[model samples]
Target: MGGFFTPDPPPPSPPPPPVIVTDPEAEAAQARQDAIARNRRGLAGTIATSETGLLQPSQGVGKSLLGE
Candidate 1:
């Protein structure tokens, strides 16, 4: 009788939300560092793109646009 009333154990509760405790001071320091890094832009001398620009299999090296 109880098994009929239980209704499938409520679908397992969705795995809980992510827990993140951010530090204000650390966040501010990171922001400042990011600002300084932003000033130093790389590959400024030449334009870069992700596309290989070649139709055939043999072509020039493919360069990563974001360097990642």
Candidate 2:
């Protein structure tokens, strides 16, 4: 009588790739660029509001629009 036999198991998967080390200088440069971009947007918005006189103080404490 013939006997049943099992096939060999598949090979193990390859290991994952190694992690890369980031450069501090490059990170700092990117942060600086981001900050500059953010500042530019803020400055533009401030300028637009100031031009429209929206940036003036809301309250006139002990003061008047015209000479007292």
Candidate 3:
């Protein structure tokens, strides 16, 4: 009879709580830094394309400012 019966252990407890804080100044500074990095990347890409002479006008666009 003992071999046919077995006991199960209880489930584990939940995890601990978390701490949260808010800082507006820090958030603004981070945003500014991110914008600067993005701008730099864009400028670098433009310069690289120009240096490689990859920029071209579309066909039949214009040969002169007046389209002459």
Candidate 4:
């Protein structure tokens, strides 16, 4: 491969931009906000399907443990 001769190497590229650093406090606040929103959505769903609607729990006799 290098038996003959190789050309000069290319010039070095410029340095990359600065790295982005995240704030731990801000990250924690965002996580807490997201969790609160998720819990609110779940509560809304539970209220919609609560026993107050036509889907109330059955107060009938309990199932027998033995195969009577």
- Using lDDT as the measure, the top candidate is 2
Error of 2 at 62 (Å): 40
Cα displacement (Å) at residue 5, model 2: 3.3
Q: lDDT tens digits, residues 1-68, model 3?
A: 13446655566888887776869999999999998888887855656556435456546544646655
Give the per-residue lDDT of model 4 (tens digit) for 1-68: 33448866677898999999999999999999998888887745656555555366656656646775
Per-model lDDT: 0.64, 0.75, 0.69, 0.75
What would the per-residue lDDT of candidate 1 be over residues 1-68, giving only the tens digit for each residue? 24866766454568878999999999999999997776675455234544343323654456646674
Error of 1 at 46 (Å): 9.8
TM-scores for candidates 1 onward, in order:
0.42, 0.46, 0.43, 0.43
Question: Ten-residue segment with the worst summed lDDT in candidate 3?
Answer: 1-10
**Which regions in candidate 3 have their CA more than 4 angstroms from the true location?**
1-6, 46-68
Quote model 1's TM-score.
0.42
Question: For model 2, what is the C-alpha lDDT against the true structure?
Answer: 0.75
lDDT of 4: 0.75
The candidate with the higher lDDT, 2 or 4, is 2
Please say which candidate is ahead in TM-score: 2 or 4: 2
RMSDs, each prediction? 10.5, 10.7, 8.2, 8.2
